[model samples]
Target: MSDTQNMLNDFRWIMDVVQNIDVGLVLLDKNFNIQMWNSFMQNHSATLAEEAIGQLLFNLFPEIDEQWFRRKTQSVYILKNSAFTTWEQRPYLFRFENYRPITGKAEFMYQNSTFIPIQGLNGEIGSICIIIYDVTEQAINNLELEKANNQLEIISKTDGLTGLLNRKSWENLLETEFQREAR
Candidate 1:
């Protein structure tokens, strides 16, 4: 095969891999217009690539905290580096539903996104690529574990039958309070 044909085949293969990836892959221009939206985004958002492309990110996701997200993307653009946002900080960017049966406890998918600045041929920041990873399972597990730990701590400090502080716990609290008051 000729070199041009081989390069075309390689490009096609890479595009196929990107489109088939499980996570959301979005490429946006400096104006925030959607340049690329992968299959993962289409499946979760129920919007086709043709529909999303060329539209402004905020226009597609009006529910997004426009100010905060704009600032985040802007930072990536200005700093010419990557920026990350976690579910704990802002939750999902597009309000996609969590379809993972194991993490069905979540109504919406928790996301952790990375905004990467795409440099142009001239070494100038051209666009940004946002990679959205579904983190519902991790977030839910962490929350459940926190609750379990809290319950365990309460159980350790309280009398089960009376639901009140145990002797040792009460004594400790009293001593601490006594010290504070004396001071």
Candidate 2:
């Protein structure tokens, strides 16, 4: 095979990987027009690449806070550095439904996303790539753990039978009050 054929084969393999990856990938131009939307995005958003391409990002997903998103992308474009957002910071950029059986309790998919600056051949930042990871499982687990911890705290402080503060709670409160009085 010729060198050109080898290059073409490599390109095809890369494209296939990008399209089929579990994470969502989106490329947006300076004007926030969709340049590329991969299979993960299509599956979640129910929007095909053909339909998404060239459309304004905000127009398709009105739920997205246009001002907030622009602020994030603007920093990437100016700094040429990547910016990240976790499910903890902002649940999701796109309000995709949670379809995974294990995390069925969650109404919407929790996501962690990265904003990457894509530099052109001329060494100028031209586009931004947004990578979205479905983190619903992790988020749900963390939330459940927090709730359990809160319940444990309450249980530790209250009487199981009477639902009133236990002896330990009263002693701690008394100590705190004594310190305040002393001050």
By TM-score, who's the top model here?
A: 2
Off by over 4 Å in 2: 101-103
Best by lDDT: 2
Candidate 2 global lDDT: 0.95
TM-score for model 2?
0.95
Candidate 1 ranges with C-alpha deviation above 4 Å: 101-103, 178-183
Q: For every model shown, what is its TM-score relative to the native structure? A: 0.91, 0.95
- Minimum summed lDDT over a 10-residue window in model 1 is located at 94-103
lDDT of 2 by residue, 1-183 (tens): 999999999999999999999999999999999999999999999999999999999999999999998888888989899999999989999999877777388999999999999999999999999999998889989999999999999999999999999999999999999999999
